[model samples]
Target: MTTHVQLHDRLDYQSVAPLMAELTAIADDMLVIDAGNVRHLGTLPLQVLLSAVRTRAAQGKITRLAHASDNCIDMLGLFGFTPETLTQPEAWT
Candidate 1:
């Protein structure tokens, strides 16, 4: 099954716990994170997302980001990440 998670507008330190909890609850083979609303992408939240993607990949599952806002994309780029590369396990290593 595919699971969809909607990202918050401000993904800062304040959003880390909830974001982690939400992503952790998914048990599907495919996880799609909607980033259209995200205006800020903090390091902590990004780390959480990265960990989730890597863990899912290790289990032979897939995790992807969709409809990312320009702000979100730019913030990710600051960390040298593109939406596609963020989901790719190999990119992390």
Candidate 2:
């Protein structure tokens, strides 16, 4: 089953650790992260997301992003992540 994770509006450095912990708990399942309400994006949270992706991949699972706001998309792009890369099932490996 796929679990939908609703991300917070502001994903700054302070929020990364908690988010990472939460995501890590569910890393064994397929995750679809909803970013529609994200108004801010920070590098720390981006790293958390990347780590979640890798964790899921290690378990032969997948993590995908959905409803990403322009800010989220732009920030991810700045970090060299495209929409396709974020959602591609094969990208994790």
- Top candidate on lDDT is 1
lDDT of 2 by residue, 39-88 (tens): 88898888888877876877888778899999888988887787569755
On TM-score, the leading prediction is 1
Error of 1 at 66 (Å): 0.4
Off by over 4 Å in 2: 87-93
lDDT of 1 by residue, 1-93 (tens): 999999999999999899999998899999999999999999999999999998899999999999999999999999999989999979666
- Taking all chains together, each candidate's TM-score versus the true structure is 0.97, 0.87
The weakest ten consecutive residues by lDDT in model 1 span: 84-93
Clashes of 2: 0
Give lDDT: candidate 1, residue 10.
Answer: 94
